[model samples]
Target: MVAILAADVAGYSRLMGSDEEGTLSHLKALRRTHVDPAITAHRGRIVKTTGDGMLVEFASAVDATRCAVKAQREMAERNADVPQGSRIEFRMGIHVGDIIIDDNDIFGDGVNIAARLEGIAEPGGVCISDDAYRQIRGKVDITFDDMGSQSLKNIAEPMRAWRSRIDTNSSTVESVRPTTETAPPLGLPDKPSIAVLPFQNMSGDPEQDYFADGMVEDIITALSQVKWFFVIARNSSFIYKGRPVNVKQVARDLGVRYVLEGSVRKAGGRVRITGQLIQAETGRHIWADRFDGELADVFNLQDQVTSSVVGAIEPSLREAEIARARCKPTERLDAYEWYLRALPHFYTLNRESLDKAIVLLGQAIAIDPHFALAKALAARCYAWRNPQGWATVPEEEKAIAVRLGREALQDGDHDPSVLWMVGFVMWQLRVDPEGALELYDRSLSLNANCAQALALRGWALATAGRLDEAVPALLQALRLSPFDPEAFFTMSALGCAYLMARRFDEAFKWTSRALRQRPTFAPALRFHAVCLVKLG
Candidate 1:
C-alpha cells in the first residue's frame, strides 16, 4: 500500500566519534525544524527516526523524493561550519513495493530493499530502485544517471539505481554511462565545485540593482566559508551574467564541477527570493524554495539561503569525493591523479595548454582510453581550438575534435565530466547550435553546479542575439565562481546585451567594470571600446 524510503547518515558514527551529545543535539534540531515539516508538507509519514537514521513511508514516490531532497539540503547547510570529518552525510534509498503497516511502524521487503539501496547511495545522495526511478522520471524536473542493475543485499534480482546527488537543472548534470568497458580513471580530489546564478532583478525600480547584485556576492561569501567546500571564485562566474545558458556550459567555463543559482525580487518593503541547488553534471533540482520576507530580514534571508545551499551541497559533495577515494587503482595505473590533472587541461581552451592536454590525454587513453576524462578533454581541446584561434587553420583540428568528442560521449557520456566536455566541443566546433544547446541543456538537467556549461551556453545565446534569455545564465556563472578567470566574459556579454537592447548607458557601465578587471581581455575591451565610440 505504501513505498518506503530508508536512509542512514554516512559518517554518523565517525561524526559522533567523541561527541555523542553534540551530534545528537544537531540531529534533533534537524528533525524538529526541517525533516518533520517537510514530510508533512509532502503528504508522507515518518515511520521512525533512529538515532543515526530514519525510515519513512510515502503514498507516492514524487512527494518522497521532494521531502528527502529538502531534508538533505537544509541539514547539510546547517552543518557547513563543522569540521569536514565530523559532518553528517545521508545516503537514501527508495523502493516502491508491497508494504505492511503495524501500529507505529511500517514493515515489508520493500523496506529492506530501500535500506539496501540507501546503503549504496552516495553520501547526501539518493538511490532509487528501477521501480522508483521509472515512476518519477518525467513527473518532476529532476534527473538521474543509471547505475545499472547491481546485486543488493536483500534484493536478489539486479537492482537498477541512479545517483540523485545533483539537481535536474545542473548544466553539468549527467548519469553514469552504461558500458562494459573497464573502469575509467578517477579525476580530481572530490571537493565539490558550485556556481550561483544571478538573481533576477525583479524590482520595478531600476535603481534597486545594487540589492540584486549584492545578493549573489553575499551568497558566494557564505558558501565559501565552509572549509569542506571548494567554492568557485566570483570573477569566472560573471562570464555568464545576463546571458541565457545551459548548466553544462557553466560547469565547463569555470573549471568547477557544480553550480547553484537563485533569484531576488524586492517590492515595497518586502522581498521574495527563489533559490535552487543543482549538481552541475546532472541538471537536477536537488533543492529549491521560494521565500518571502521584509527587507529588514535581509541578513536572515541571506543566512537562511546559505544554510539551505550548504546543507544541500556539502553532503553530496562529500559523498562524491568519498566515492572517488574509494576507487582502487587498476594494475599499472594511477587513475585518480591522472583524472585529477585532466579536469583542468580538459577545460583549457588555450592553444598551448590544450596541446599539452592532448599529449597527456593520449597517455591517459593509452593507459585507459576507456578513461572518460581523457576522452572528454581531448574532444574539448579540439572543439575550442579554432574559435579560440588556438590553432593555425583550425578547420581540420575542429573536425577531428568533433569526431572525438562524440566518441568520448559514446564511451561514457553519463559521467558529468565526459558529457560536459562533449557538449562544449559540439558548441565550439561543429557550430551545430541546436545539438550543442541540447547537450548543454541536458548536462544542467543532471547537475546545477556546472557553471562552465552555463557560461558557454550564455555566451552562445548572446552571440546568437538572444539578449533577454542570456541574462540569468551569465549572472549564475558569476555567482558560482566569483573569481573565475572568465567572469569578465559574462560581464562583457551583459554589457553587449545591454548595448544591443539599446540600454546604452548600462552597457557602458558594465563594460567599464569589465575593463577594470581585465583591461586587455578582448571581449570586455572590444565592448568597452565600442561603448566609448558610440557614446562620444
Candidate 2:
C-alpha cells in the first residue's frame, strides 16, 4: 500500500475564466516556491498534474500528511493579502491504499478515494482517510478533528475522515486537546421533547448489542414521527451509550423535557423489552412498562413501547397518531432482521460497509418484496453510491435506484420514513425535483418533525433557485434538530439560499458556521468561496 495525496485549486475554473494567463502564472509560481519544496522535503513524488490539481505518491502516510499541512500553511500565508476574489486556495485529500503502477501512471481505489476527498475538502484545508490518520496520529504533532464517516463519491462503503487543524497565529502546528467543558444547558423546545438513551443489552451475548441498538433506533424513529414531539436525533442521543446516565442531566444536556431509558433481553426465541418515561424537570416516572413477546412479534413490542411513551407524554394523544406511529415496516420477521442488520453498516459510510448494507437490504427486500422500508433504504444506498463515485455502473445503479424508489413510494405512501428516504433518493439522483418536493411535503404532513426531509427539501429548493422558500425550511430543520450531527448540511443549504438571494454577508456567515462544524463539506466550501468573492 502507498499513500496518495490529491489536491486542486478550489475555484480554478472561475479564476481561469477571469484571467487565464495570470491564474496559470500564479499557480506555477506557487508550485515552484511552496508546493514542490514541501513534497521533496517530505519524500513525496508528483505522479501527475492536471493544470490546477496534482496527484502525489508518498511512501509514508506521516510524510504525506505533514507535506499537506505544510503546503496549506504556506498557501495561507501567500494569500493573506491577496484580493479575496483573486486568491487561489487548494483542497487536499489523502488516503493510504494499494495502487497499480502502469506506464509511469498510478491508479486504483487509493487514487480515487484521495481525489474524491479532495473534491469535498475545504479550500485551504486537508482531509485524510481513517487509514492515513491511524498511521500519523502520534507521529505528527498536528491536531485532527474527527469528521465521522463520510460517503465519498463513487467510493464503496463509508470511510471515517479526519481534518488537520491549522493554527493561523503560529508557524508551528499545535495540538488542541478536547476539553471537558460543556456548553450551557440548552432551553427546552416549545413542544414536548424527549431523548431515548441506547437500550442496554441484557442478553449476555455481546453480539446481540446490534439487536438492542437497532431497537433503540426504531423507538427513536417512531417517536420522531409524532408530529408534536421534539425528539433528539439518534446521533446526539447515542453519545451517552455504554455509560451511566442521569435522566435530568440528559434532559439538560439535550434540552428535552422527558428522557426514555430502556433495556432489551432476548433468549430462546423470546424477547422482553422494558421502558420507562421520566419527566426530566421533576424526576418523576410518568410511565413505565415491560413488554414480553415471541421473537417473531418484536415489532409489536416496539410499537407498544412507542405508544406507551407517547401516551405517557400526552394522555389525550389521538388514536390516529398512535396508529400512524405503529405502522409496521414489514410483516416478515426475517426481513425485518435483515433490515436491522443493514443499518449499522449503512451509517459507517465506507465502500465496503455500504456495499454490505446494500446486500443486507437486498436480502430483506427479497424475503419480502413488498417491504417498502427495505426497498427505500436499498435505493438510498444506491443513490449514495452514485454521488460518492462508488457506483461501478452509473446507469445500472441509477435504474435500480429509480425502480426501488418508485416501488417504495407506491407501497409506502403512508409511511413517513419511506416517503422521506425515497424523496431524498429522488432529489439526489435527479429523478425529479418537483416530485421530490411533493414527497417531502407528504412526509412532513405525516411526521412534521422529519428534519431530514425538511433539510433535503430546503436543499432542493435552494438548488432550484427558490431562495424564499428554501431558507425557512432549512431554518426549521435546524430548529427541530439543534444537536443533529448533520446540522451542517442544513447550515450549508441556508448559505446557498442566502447566496442566491444576493445576501453575501449572510451567506458568508452561515457557510463559515458550517465549515466550522465540518470543514470538508464541499457545498459549504464552494458557497463560502463564492461568498468571499461577492463580498470582496
Candidate 3:
C-alpha cells in the first residue's frame, strides 16, 4: 500500500464540546460548500468525518495538499457572512505513509503522523512532510517555508516539514528563502533615531493636545539637529495621538532607536511636563524626569526635554547600534495612515480588536495600494482571523494576509513596523516562527526603540528557547509602555521566560502581577496552572 496523505482540524473535538450542534452545522456547511468540492477536484476521497473534523485519503501527497489549500481558501470566503464567534477553523497536515485499509476506515502511522503535524499548524494552515513538499513544490502557486524537522509523538524518526504561504495576490507561491542585506546603517555618531509622542494633556483644554503635540515636533527637530542619529519625521510620530499605545510599537512604526513619551498638564497658567526616555531594543526606560514652570515657560520645557531625552537615549542607542541595519519603505501619507490603523489593531492584541483593525486597515490600503504598513497589517490580520476563530472563512484571511505581507515587504522591506507585523502573523498564525524571529531582529536593528519589534523579538526568542535574551526585552517593553494595556503581554512574557529559566518563584511572581491586571487571560491562566503543578 502507498503511504496515505492525510489532514485534520486541531481542537475540533473541543470546539464541539461547547456547542456540538452549531459546530456540526457549520462543519457540514463547509464540507458542502468548499471541502467536498475541492476534494473531488483533487480526486481525493473522504475516508470519514469526525464530529468536528474529517479524515481524507488521497492517492498522492501533492493532491492532498492542493486540495487542502484550495479548501481552506474557499471556506474562508464562504464563512465571511458568519459571525466571528461561530467560525469553523481547520488545521491541516499531510504525510505519506502506508495505511491499513479497514472497511472505509484508515488506521496507521500515516494517519497519526498527519494528526501530529496538524497540531503544529496554525489554525487554518497546512503543514506537509518532506515527501509531500517534494511532490508539490513547483506544482502549485503555494510557496513552502521550511520548518526544519520536528519530533512527533510515537514517531521514531523526526519529520522535516515546510509551511505553505498561499499567495492570493500574484498566484506564484514559491519556497521561502533567506535574503541578503546591502545597505549599511545610516551611520550615526553620537545621537540616535527617535520619536516624541503626545504626552497626556491633563489640562481641561482639548486644545492642549496641539501643545503637547508641538512639544513632540520640537523634540524631533532638536534631535534632528544633533548632527547624528536618524530622527523619524514628526508626521510619523504624531500618528499615535489620542490612542493609548505601546512604546515598542511606536519605535517600530517610526523607525527610531529611541522613544520620548510624556504628558503636559496646565492649570491656572502653570504647566508641568513629564518625559521619559526609552531604549527600544531592551524595552528599557533609561531615564525619566518632570519639569515644572508657567505655561509661558513651555519653550524652556521643550528645551529641557529635548536635551534630556537626547542625552539619555544616545548612549543606550549607541551601545545597541554596535550592530545596526538600514531602512526601507514609504515616506508617503497613504502609507502613514495604513501604519496608524494597523498599529492599534496589531498592538490591541485580542480577537475583537484584530477584526476591527482588519477592516480599518483594508480601508487604509484602499487609499494607498502601495502603502506597506496597510499591506503588512492586512497580512497579519488575515493570519489572526483564521486560527483565532475570528471569522468563518479562515483560509481566505490567510491567503490575503500572505499576499499583502509579501507585497508590503516588496514595497519596502526596510520599514521596521511593517516587517515586525508581517513576521508576527507568519510566526504565530502561519507556523513559521523562525522566519518571524529573523524579521523581528532585522526590524530592531533598523529601529532599536520599536517596542512592538522588541516584544515580538522576545516572544520569538522565548519560543526558540532563548529565554535569557527574552527576559530583558520583555522588561524593556513594560518600561516603554507603562500606561498602555499592552504592558500585560510583556509581564506575561517575562513570567514565561522565568519559567523556562526554571526560576519558578520569579515566574509565579511575575505571572501573578500580570493576572492582577487581566485575571481572565487564558494563556497566563494556563501557564500559572502549570507552574502550580510543577511546584506542587
Candidate 4:
C-alpha cells in the first residue's frame, strides 16, 4: 500500500493566458527548487508529472500529508506579495490504498480517488480521503476540518473528505518561518490604505456574530467604492478573527496604514455598535464612537453604523497623514507626501500655518501638475486666505483659486474628495452658492458616506436661509461622525441650521456641543456667542 498525493494548479489556463512565459517560468522554478526538495526530504517519489500538475507516492500516509500541508503553506508565503489577480495557488489531495505499479508509474483506484479529492479541495488547501485521514490522524500535529462525504467526479462511491487548515504555527520552519526579525511589510499603495478588522461579537450568542461580520463586510464594500482608498479584502481581514491581534502587526501584514476595530452588543431588543479607528503605525487612536438602535431596525442601524464609521475614518486618516507629514521636514518629501504634511497647518486656521500650507501645496503642485487633490487643497488655501484677512489682493487670489478649482474638477469630478474641496472653494472664493450646492449633491451621490460633504451642504443651505433643508443633512453628518476631527464644524453647522429655523434653545445646545469638542474653534465660538446674545 502507498499514499498517493495528487495536486493541480487552480485556474492554470487563466494564469497562462494572463502571462504565459512568466507563469511557465515560475511554475517550473517552484517545482524544481521547493516541491521536489520537499518531497525528497519526506521520502516521497514523484510518479509522474503533467504540464500543470503532478502525482507522487509516499511510503506512509503521514509523510504524504505533512508534505502536502507544508507545500501548500509555503506556496501561500511565496505568493503573498504577488498581485491578487495573478497569484498562483494549488489544491492538493491525498489517498492511501493498494496501487498497481507498472513501468515504475503507479495506477489504480488510489490515484483516481486522490485526483477526485483534489477537485473538491480549496485553493491553497489540502484534502484527504477517510483511509488517509485515519492513518495520519494521530501521527501529525495538525487538525482537519471534516468536509463530510463529497461526491467526487468520475468516482463510483462517495468519499469521506477532510480538509487541512493552514496552521499558522506549522513546523514547516525552513519554508514558512519569518525570514528576519522584521518580516517584509506589505508595500503601501499610491493612495490611503486601510483594513477593517472583524468586529468582535459581545452579545454572548454566537448567532449574533453574523450580524457583526455582516456589518464589517458591508463597510468594506462601501469603502471600496470611495475610489481614492485601497481597502483590504474581507478574506484577508477575517483571518485575524477570534485571535488576540496587535494592531501595528496587522497594519504591517495587511500593508494598510489605518485599522478599524469594533464590537457589536445586543440586549433587550437593542443593538449597540462601538468602533475605533487607529493610526496603526503610531499606535494612536484617531477616533472612537458608539451607536445604539432598536433591533427591529437592524438594517437601518447597520447603514447608520457604516456611514458613521466611514465618515469618521476619512477625517481620522487625513489627520494621521497630517501628523506624519509634520514629523518629516517638507524638503525631504515628494509631491503627495508634502501635500499630506501640509494639511495640519491648513486646518489650524492660523495666519502663519495657513501661509505655510499654501507654500507647501505650491511645491506639491509644481512637482506633479496633474495632482488633483493637491490642486484642490491649494485652491482652498487661497479661498481661506481671504476669509482670514491674510490675502493682500483678495479678488486676485479668488480668481486664482477658482482657476485651480476648475482645473481640479476637470479630471477629478469623479473623486469625492476633490468634489467636496472644489465645492468649498467655489462657495468661499467665488461666492457661487448655486455651484457649490450642485457639486455637493454630485459628491453625495458618488459617496453616500461622505459626511463632510453632507455637512457642507447643510452649512450652505443654512447660510442661504433654507433652515428646514439644512437641518437634516447637518444632523446626519453629526450622527455619522461623532468623533470627527472636524467635530466643531459639524456641530456648528447644526447649530447654525437651528438658529436659522428660529429654534434659539436648540441652537445654543448644538453650539455648546461644538465648544465642548474644540474650546476655541472660531466658528463654534461665534455660534455660541451669537446664541447666548439672542437669548439675552
Candidate 5:
C-alpha cells in the first residue's frame, strides 16, 4: 500500500484554448518553481504526468498532504493578481491504499479513488480519503474539514472524505458558481434518468474512434431497454462530444440525474473499456469499472461492456434513488418515491424490515394501482413472510400474493424486474415450477445481465432437480454481481444445487460461504448440516 496524490488544472482545456502558448509556458514554469519543489521537499515521487495533471506517489500520507498543501499555497500566491478566468488553479485528491505496481507505474483502487476524489475537489483545494485522513490526522498541523461519505465513481462502497481547509492568511479559496446565463435546468424525468456521453479514444489511434463511439451508442441503447430508466437519446448526449465538460453542468443541460462517461483504449491484440457513472446533482460517483478482451472479439467485448455496465448501474442507481427519497419530506413522496423507500427495508432480509417493506409497497400501490413493480415486490414480501413464520393469516397472504403476482404480470410482463420478482413469488408459493422457469427465462431474454433473475432461476432449477443447469446459472449470477446484497441467497441456492447433485464437498463449500454472509440463513444451515452428515 502507498499514498497516491492526483492533481489537475481546474479548467485546462479552456486555458489552453484561450492562449495555448502562454498556458503551456505558465504550467511549465509553475511545475519547475512551485509544484516540483514542494514534492521534492516533502519526499514525494512523481509517478507520471499528463498534459494538465500528474500522479504522485509518497511513502506516507503526511508527505502527500504536505506536498499538496504547499503547492496550492504557492499557486494561490502566483494567481493572486491573475483574473479568475485565467488563473491556473489546481484540484488535488489523496488516498492511501493498496496499489498494483506494473512497469514502474501503479494501477488499482488506490489510483482510481485518488483520481475521482480530485474530480470533486474544489479548485485550489485538497481532498483525501478516510484512509489517508486517519494516517495524517493530528500527525500533520494542517486542518481538514470532514466531507462526509462520498460515492466516488467505480469504487464499490461510499468512502468518507476530508478536505484540507486552506489557511485564509496564506491562500484564499474561491467558490466557483455555475453561470445563470444558460437555460434553466431541465426537470428530471419521473423514472430514474441518465445520459451516456461518448467514450474517449485513449489508444491515440484515430481509427479506433469509431469503436469507442459505437460502444457508447450500444451502451445507451442497452440501458434504454431497462424499463425503469429514462435514458437520454444519442443525439442529445453526443452534442457534448470532443468537449471538456463539468458533469453537474451536463446534468443540468441534459435534465438527467445520472451521467455515464468512459474511455476505450486499444493495444496490440487487446482492448480495454473503462466506464464511470456519477450523480449529476452532487457530483458524486455511483459506479465505475473496466472491461478488457482480445481485439478479435471486439464486438463481443462491446456487448460485454454494455451488459456489465447496465447491470452494475441498475442497482447503484436504485440505491442512490432510495437515498434521495429518504431525504425528502415524507408527506411529499410520490408513488415512485414510496417504492424506492421500500427497497432498503426489503433487502434487510428480516421479519420486521420485511413487514415495513410490505407497508411501504402497499402505500405505493394505493397511490398508483397500476404500479406493477410495487405489486410484484409486495407479492414477494407476502410469499417470504409465510416461510419465516411471520404471516398471521397464511391463506389470506397466499391469495393476496397470487392475485398481486397475476396483476403484476398483466401490467408489467415487459419489465425484467417485475417478471423475475413475480416468478420468485410464484416459485416460493409453489404455484408451478415450469411457469416460474418460463418467467425467469423470459426475464433473462430481456436482460441477460439481470443477476437477480439468474439467481432465482438457479434456485428454481435446483429445487426441480435440474442440478446441471442450476450450478452454472448460480455461478454466472455471482460473477455478474459479486458484491450484490442478495449474494448470500445465490450462494445458498448453489449449495442446494450441489447437494441435490450429491456433490457433498461443493455443497459444504457454498453453504459455508453463505453462512459466513448470513449465519442464520435457514436453507444454508440445513444444506450445511446435510452436507456434513453426507460427507461423514
Candidate 6:
C-alpha cells in the first residue's frame, strides 16, 4: 500500500493572467524552498510533477498528513508579505490504497482518488479519503472534519472524505486572522476593497450548491474587472463558504472595507438571487437588491445582480472616500493619499477644484513615476482642461496627455481603468477614433461591468456613422450604471446616437437627462440645444 498525495495551485490561470512572469518565479521558489524539503522530510517520494500540480507517494498516511499540514502552514507564512491577489496557495488531497508501481511512478484508483479529492479541497486546505483518514486517525495530531461523500469527476462511485483544519492555537503561524482584537483594526487598501462571500443555496438540494457557487464565481470575476477597487480572489473568499461569519469579522480577516453576501433560491424553473453590500467598518448596509428570472435566463440574472451591485457600490464608495478625504489633512499626503484627496475635487466639475485636482495629481505622479492610475487620471485632467478652455497651451496639453495615456496603458495593460482612461483621452484628443474604439473594446473585454468603456464605445461608433449599433450599446451602458457619477456621458452618447438616426424626440429626452446630471458638460449642452432646435 502507498499513501498518495496530490496537490495543485488554485486559480493558477488567473494568477498568470495578472502577472505571468511573477507567478512562474514564485512557483519555482516555493517548490525549491518549501515544498521539496517538506516532502523529503516526511520520507515522501515525488512520483511526478505536472505544470501546476504534483503527485507524490509516501509509505505512511500519518507522515503524509504531517507533511501537508506543515507545508500549508509555511505557505501561509510565506504569503504574509505578498499582496492578496498575487499570493500562491494550494489544495492538497491524500489517499492510501493498493497501487501499481510502474518505473517509480504509481497508478490506479489510489492516485485517481487523491487527484479528485485535491480538486474539491478548499484552497490552502487538505482533504483525505476514508482509507487515508483511517490510517492517520489516531497517529496524526490533527483535527479532521468529515466532508461526507463527494461525487468526484471521472471517478466511479462516491468517496467519503475528511478535510484537515489548521489548529488555531497550535499553528506555527496564524492561518486565520483574528476578528476582535481591541487595539488596532486592519488597515484598509488605498481604494475601495470588497470580499464577496459565497452565496447560500436555499433550495435544500445539495446539487443546487454548484449553481449557487457558479453564480458567485461569475460575480467575483466581474467585480475584479473594476480597476478602481480591490477584490479578494475566489480561493480566499470561498474559505467563508457554508460557515456562519460576521461581516465585520470577514472584513478584518480579509482586510477589506466592504463585504457582499447573498443567497440563491431555485425552484419550479425560476431563480432568485439577492445580494447586499455592507460597509464593514461601520457595519452599515450600503446597498441591497434582488433579481428574479426564469432558469433559462440564469446568466442574464447574474449579469443584472452583478451590474446592480457594482453600480450601487460605486457611488457609495465615492461618497465614503470623499468623506474620508475631508477628514485628513492634505499637507502630509503621499501618492495614494494625494490621489484620494484629488477625487472630491475632481468630482466638483468646476474650474477652481478641477485645476486643484490637476495640481494634486501632478504631485502624486512626481512622488511615484510608475503610478499608472495617477498617470491616467492626470491625463484625464489634461483632456478635461483643453476642452473647458482652461488650458494655456491646448495643443501642447493634448500632446502631453496622449503621451501620458500611452505610458499608463503600457504600465497597466491588464487594468481596466487604465485602458478606459487611455481610450477616453484618445477620443477627446481626436488622436485616432479607430484606435480609441479598439482600446474601449479591450477595456470591456477585461471588465464587462465597465459602463464607462461601453459608453465611450457607443460615442466612438456614433461618430463613425454607425448609429444603429451605437444606440443599443449606449442604452446598455445606461442600464448598467443608472446612477453612475458620470451618467452624463452615457446619456449624451445615447442622445448623439439618436440624433444621427433622426429620432428627434428620443434624442431630446436623453439630452435633457444628460443636462440634468451635468449642465456644464459641453457635449451634452450642445446636444440638448440642438435637440430643442430640432423639436421647435
Best by lDDT: 2
Which lDDT tens digits does candidate 3 get at residues 1-536? 34344455544665588689877787777779888999899988888776656788888877888888888777656655654345676778888888898788989888888877776665567888777788777787676665555667788987776665343444555332112123222322243566677667655456445556645644654555454555554444555666545555555544467777777766555677777676665555567778888755666676777666655755554333232222223334334434554554565667878777777777777777787767887787777567656766777667777788878888868766778988977786755788888898877666665666777788778767898789788866554334445556667777788888888888888788788877867567877887798789
Prediction-by-prediction clash tally: 106, 17, 17, 0, 3, 0
**Model 2 poorest 10 in a row by lDDT:** 172-181
The residue-level lDDT of candidate 4 at 325 comes to 8
Q: What lDDT does each candidate get?
A: 0.67, 0.84, 0.67, 0.75, 0.78, 0.76
TM value for model 5: 0.48
Measured against the true structure, the TM-scores of the candidates, in listed sequence, are 0.41, 0.64, 0.44, 0.44, 0.48, 0.43
Of the candidates numbered 3 and 5, which has the greater TM-score value?
5
Tell me the tens digit of each residue's lDDT in model 4 across 352-376.
9988998988888888777777788
Looking at model 3, which ten-residue stretch has the lowest summed lDDT?
176-185
**For every candidate structure, what is the RMSD over all alpha carbons to the true structure, in angstroms?**
20.2, 23.5, 26.5, 16.7, 18.4, 18.8
Q: Give the TM-score of candidate 4.
A: 0.44
Quality of model 5 by C-alpha lDDT: 0.78
lDDT of 2 by residue, 1-536 (tens): 99999999976896899899999999999999999999999999999999899999999999999899899988888887775567888999999999999988999999999998887676678989999999998887677755556667798797877775355567545432222136765777888998898897766567788889989988988888777788887867877777655565677777889989878877667887988787877665577678988988898888889989988888788455573466688888888889989988887667799899999998999899999999999999999889878999999999999999999988898888888889989898888878999999898887787778889999999999988889999987876666666778889999999999899999999999999988877779999999999988
**301-341: candidate 6 lDDT, tens digit per residue:** 76666666666767654333221001111122256556756
Q: Which tens-of-lDDT digit does each residue in 371-436 have in candidate 1? A: 655677777776656765677667788777877777777766555445656877776665677777
TM-score of 6: 0.43
At residue 258, candidate 5 shows an lDDT of 84
In candidate 6, how many clashes are counted?
0
Give per-residue lDDT, candidate 5, residue 514: 95
* Candidate 6 local lDDT, residue 469: 76
